[model samples]
Target: MNKISFMLNGEKVSLYVEPNDLLLDVLRDKLGDKSPKYGCGRGDCGTCTVLLNGKSVRSCLILAIEVDGQEIMTLEGLSKNGLTDLQKYFIKHSSFQCGFCAPGMIVTLDEFLKKNPKPDEEEVKEAISGNLCRCTGYVPIIRAVMDYVKNRGG
Candidate 1:
């Protein structure tokens, strides 16, 4: 096993990981980070999304060893301080139903908002297109993000 060290949720963390072990597995199994759920193991599903060096990526598709010296941010990290504005907006808009996609959608949007603080409705829809939520039909999710952006002066 190769030892890998990376910044997780603004904290430095190191652990032994096999070259073939997926980042999602290491985070959930070894590190006990349960936010990045194992939905579709393939990259098609965004349920395993996480931020890698401030960018959204599918943790399931990345090898743990590849994150050595990198930075990862999961929903657990994003909410470490408490409910972020986006999260509050989500709650206000009732964005989620089953909530399985909440973490990935939130994480993905967190990065997107940082990149494009002022995004149109279509842009917000496109940003969360990868995350599939069978319930809520995505209308509420879009509204929540748009509202958050507007409230943030974007």
Candidate 2:
């Protein structure tokens, strides 16, 4: 095992991880942060997406050691100050159904909104295009994103 340190949800964390351990596994199994779920291990499902250095990335595709010096943000991090505006909008619009993809979707959306604070519907859709959601049917998700952008906050 190798010791690695990084900023996780604004907190500095150090842990021992195997070189071959995937970030998703480290977060979920080792750290007990269950926000980033295990879906398609190949990284195609996007259910394991998380913010790495303020950008969205597939945790499954990243080795735990790769985040040694980076900032990692999972969905749970978004609730530190209570529910954020984006999260409220998600709830207001019922953006999630089965909820399995909610964490990744929220993490991805958090990064996307930061990059494009005022994004159009198409842009919002494009931003979360990397994530896949099966239950809500894209309509509600799109509406929530667009509405959140329109409100600018709340």
Candidate 3:
């Protein structure tokens, strides 16, 4: 096992991980955060998305040991005191149906909006292109993101 240290949900965390263990496994099996689902398990599906240093990444594509000293943010970290504005907007717009891809979509959208606060429709779609949702057909998701941006005066 390799000892890895990283920041999770704004708190410093350290744990032992097997060399072959994926970040998704460590986060869910070890850290007890199940939001990053084990979908596809091959990185094609973005259901396991997380933020590494404020950038969206597929946790299933990364080894637990590779994240040493990095700052990781899961869906749980996005809400400070309660539901974030984005989260509220998503719910208000019914962006999620089955909710399988909500966590990754939210994290990806959060990172995207941070960089491009006023993203065009295409830009918004491109930002979440990595994530695949079988529900809502993506229109509602895009609308929710646009609404959030508008509400924030971006």
Among these predicted structures, which one has the highest TM-score?
A: 1
Q: Provide the lDDT at 90 for model 3.
A: 92
Off by over 4 Å in 2: none
Q: All candidates: CA RMSD in angstroms?
A: 0.7, 1.4, 0.9
lDDT of all predictions = 0.94, 0.88, 0.92
Decreasing lDDT order of the candidates: 1, 3, 2
The TM-score, computed over Cα atoms with residue i paired to residue i, of candidate 3 is: 0.97
Pairing residues by index, what is the TM-score of model 1?
A: 0.98
Better of 2 and 3 by lDDT: 3
- Candidate 2, residue 134: lDDT: 85
Positional deviation of residue 69's Cα in model 2 after best superposition, in angstroms: 1.8
TM-score of every model?
Answer: 0.98, 0.95, 0.97
Ranked by lDDT, the better of candidates 1 and 2 is: 1
Error of 1 at 61 (Å): 0.3
Across residues 42-61, which tens digit of lDDT does each residue of candidate 1 receive?
Answer: 98879999999999999999
- Candidate 3 ranges with C-alpha deviation above 4 Å: none
- Residues 10-112 of candidate 2 have per-residue lDDT tens digits of 9999999999999999999988899898998988888999889998999999999999999998988888888988889889998888889888888888887
